[model samples]
Target: MSDSLFRLDAAQLAELIRSREVSPVEVVQAHLDRIGGVDPQVNAIVTVAPDALNAAKAAEAAVMAGEPLGPLHGVPFTAKDSIDTAGVPTQRGSPIFRGRTPARDATSVARMKAAGGILLAKTNLPEFSYWIESDNLLSGRSNNPWDLARTPGGSSGGEAAAIAAGMSPLGLGTDLAISVRGPAAQTGITSLKPTHGRVPMTGIWPRAPRRFWHVGPMARSVRDVALAFSLLAGPDGQDAFATIAGRAEVGAGPQSDRPLRVGWMVGPGFGPVDPEVVATVRAAAEALATFGVQVEPVGIPALERDFALDVFNRLHVMEMKPAFREATRGHEGEMYRMAKTMLSLPDTSMADFIDAEQAAERLRDGYADYFSRFDALITQVLPIPAHHHGADKFAIDGQEVDATYLQGATVPLNVTGLPGLSMRFGTSRSGMPINVQLVGAWHAEATILHVASLLESVSPVQGLFPNI
Candidate 1:
């Protein structure tokens, strides 16, 4: 029962706890034990919440007392180190902020707790949460559970690794470009990057580029992600960007009367993708087609004209560099690869920044136009499967590309403030996970999640967990 408890998703745990079949303490202890046993190899958890068991005891009391329960009542959840957890060290994955504990939880974390979820631990991330890999000066690095030699994917890599390894069933991760989704893809888990502004960013780091930053849920199942999203979304009043009031219902796919329309693409705008990755995207589209959904291969002209990655780089660097400079002012010696790299990059020229802004608008317009005809889009989450640690260049499908190429299909969503779900749908020949991105127009998280649930039912890689 203890071993099986660690394997259950958050929803399942909640059901068991509510039914008195499993005590909250038992469920939380199982995950804590799992972390103790698995984290040494994964290096995913940075700091376990000292009061985790105590919180579980309190939750158990609630169940015993017959108190009203929240949706995630008694389930344990982990968060990236970059997200604040009151009294727990948030360190931001850098030595400069080591031992820095926040006085309050981030809006996402607070909401999770409010829903009766236990804060299990804080996960690892790259220095300043800026890289695509989760290595940092303070907590070392995180390895993919699927292949220890390869990375889980960065910034939110630790959260992804933890959930994949069964250390935590549900977790919170922030995505600027590919932090949440890329890591989820590499780890063979499911993650949701809800429409921008859907979740508040209060108490999270690197808020300078707040427009692109998003806080969302990473979990083992699409329904768990959807459950977490429903609880996490809406205005907290503290974040000016989180203007959407109340919890927006996760849409129930396309209206029951009409079939959903989806477009699948892998190139031209997103750069050269590996053949396997392309095949995975095609398979997802084909699966949707067989489900009676309108599926077609399509391209967005604006993405071809104004590459979203280039636009993101220009706009973000100008805004993000200042925050990095301010944070690392006196602690430059403690900085790691990503911070140093970001600091060394040239600032965008005024003219170039303006051009990039226009490009971003164009990208948004292009997505709007696409959504006008299609309800969602399908694309490869990464150009290739998880790569070895420290790899910065790759020969993807005969084209030499930099590491940033991994964000090709993902950055456009950030640029357009759209929502996307990343879930495992295929496996590479080498046995690594290959995930496809499910994209929805702004505020259409429900629609994408609905489609993702459909894909989840038909995914060829269903119930496949890492051998770890």
Candidate 2:
């Protein structure tokens, strides 16, 4: 019975705990036991919170005492090391800040705990949370559970890997480019990259350039994502961007009766895409259409120019480099290789910055125009499935491509501050997970989550688990 406990979703555990069917301690212990059994092979978790079991006991007492329970009461969740946790070490996968523990939890983490969720552990990530793979000088690399030789994607790879492998039922991961969504794609799970600033960034590392950064929920199901999102959203009085604009209902909404017009694409648009990935995305669209969604093939002309990636590169290097360089000043030698490389790049000139900003405006307008016509746009989360470990480049249908192309499909949504949910659709011939992105207009997370819930009902990867 304890062995099967890890297979239950966050909602299931919460329901059991609420009805006194399963004690909180049992649920938390099952995950800890699972982590003990699998983490040596996966390397997804960096630090197991020492107080987790004590908290679970407290939660159990609350249940027995008949105290009111929060939505996720007694459930356990993990967080990418980039996000701050009050007592747990948040090394951010860099040796420079090893043993560093924040004074208070990040808004998202604190909020989750307030809702009765226990902090199970801290997961791995790229050094300084700056790259697309979770490997660092501090905790080592995190391997995909599906095939130990492949990557789980990043900078939230560890979060996705932990959830997919059943070490944790839900988690919080930060997204800049494809950090959250891409990893969710690489691993066979689901993640929500809420509209930029929908969640607070108060205690996260390298807090400057708060524009593109986002803190979001990742889990085995879209319903869990929505449940976490509802708790994390709204102004925290710290993040100016998180100001309320009126919230969108998640599972319950009037849009269910009306057919949702969704635009689907697999391209010549976001650079060269793997053939299998393209086929899987089309199949996912068809599955949604079966549920009465108005799914159609549509192209965003600006994406064909690959302007999204270009814009993000220009802005990122300009905005992030200085702060990163300052943070690693004397500790440069201790940082990850990618962090050093990013800092050594040439500075962006005013002319290039202006040009890139203009291009960004165009990309935002393009998505705005598209959303005006369709309820959402469905596309590939990554052009390819999880590539082998240490691969600097991968081939798509016999053509070689740079590793950075991993973020091609996801950067546009970041630049536009649009919400996107990356959920499993199918599996590759090699058996790696395949995911598609459901993008909605700014602050349309509920709409996208609603659509995703419908997609989840018939997901090809639904009920599947990694053999690990």
Candidate 3:
């Protein structure tokens, strides 16, 4: 096996293909081979595309025949099981949809393929993409690339694990609050959640997240993320949220002559955070200062701990009932019980939905005001590193917190419908990834990506190498 080929970044492979130094088929084959080597132990991929090799061959033919190519031409990537893939079974890590395969690729998958990317496999996710841990009846569980007994984090855990293990350079992962960002943090990959409507949420599972869910790129490098964003950002007619993709897309804004100003919350609307996580956030901010940016702590008292948790739980309970109510009635046992609990809550009535929407609006307005003054917001993707596998609850700084708190640094963005990104800040002692988020103004992912690129350059969060 050519280890170097599997290890090459998407941009590196693109350069080689563009220079006629390597064929697209060769690049795609390398990723397939990488999956073969590592995916068994990790169980990150649920369904492999038998025709990926053929697709890559066709891409090579296109290049050889002098056809127009997309920016990610010949890059190999994966999609989360929750996202539809044509001709591939999208089990969504649930038995309820066991034999389900869409007649069409998801808007995101179609966009990636159209951009010259080869979709090799469908990655695993939690059942119905509901829980934080990535395990389900149909696809089973995904283990962390660094530690098998530990979680890679979910519902995009499989995507994160595969990318971290070099099974693929990039994967399409969705985030309601922190699925993409959280898993990326746990597995040592980088991701960007474009503004809610910037990318189409069509074909993403639980389909109810139309209001808050965002589908975006998970990659090993910031540049790869930017490249993925470019491919995935175009308008798709099926999605209602996507408005004017032509203008919503990211690119170089006016070149800044002044060092950027950064405002970071010590924690979320919460008071104190884990020492290690706070250290990581502080270290990340200090690292940014060295990049010639002004870093200062900014507080969002309105978005405080209780309020953030309230927003997260209310949204989860209210929004997810429709997606899982049917599944619970049919499916039995633990997973069914979990879904029941989410649906069983009383605070999720029609009035509650309206209230949540109103609260979401207020939250959005708050972020608008917050971003009005600051160029970027820096914060922890979570209060601490990955907990034991399948653990329901955790504590930050000795205070008991629930799974909802896991979305601490993340929920506000979702509530307000703003774009926020999480990238690897550093690594925890256990080799778990410590990550930070950069929340920019509404559609200003370019600024956040720019600063994240700066942080990625200095952090010890190295992209995974191929074990194949």
Candidate 3: 10-residue stretch with minimal lDDT: 246-255
Question: Backbone clash tally for model 3?
Answer: 3
For model 2, where is the 10-residue window of minimal lDDT?
A: 245-254
What is the number of backbone collisions in each predicted candidate, taken in the order shown?
Answer: 2, 0, 3
Estimated TM-score per prediction?
Answer: 0.99, 0.98, 0.94
- Tens digits of per-residue lDDT for model 2 on 283-355? 9889889878899999998776546888888888889988888889998678778888988899899999999
What do the candidate models score in CA lDDT, each in turn?
0.92, 0.89, 0.80
> Across residues 364-455, which tens digit of lDDT does each residue of candidate 3 receive?
77777787677888988878787778787777788887776787777777777777788877767766778888888877888888888788
Candidate 1 or 3, higher lDDT? 1
Which segments of candidate 3 are over 4 A away from where they belong?
A: 246-256, 327-337, 347-354, 463-468
Candidate with best TM-score? 1
For model 3, how big is the CA root-mean-square deviation?
2.3
CA-only RMSD, every prediction: 1.0, 1.3, 2.3
- Ranking the candidates on lDDT from highest down gives 1, 2, 3
> What's the distance in Å from true for residue 390, model 2?
0.7
**Pairwise lDDT winner, candidates 1 and 2:** 1
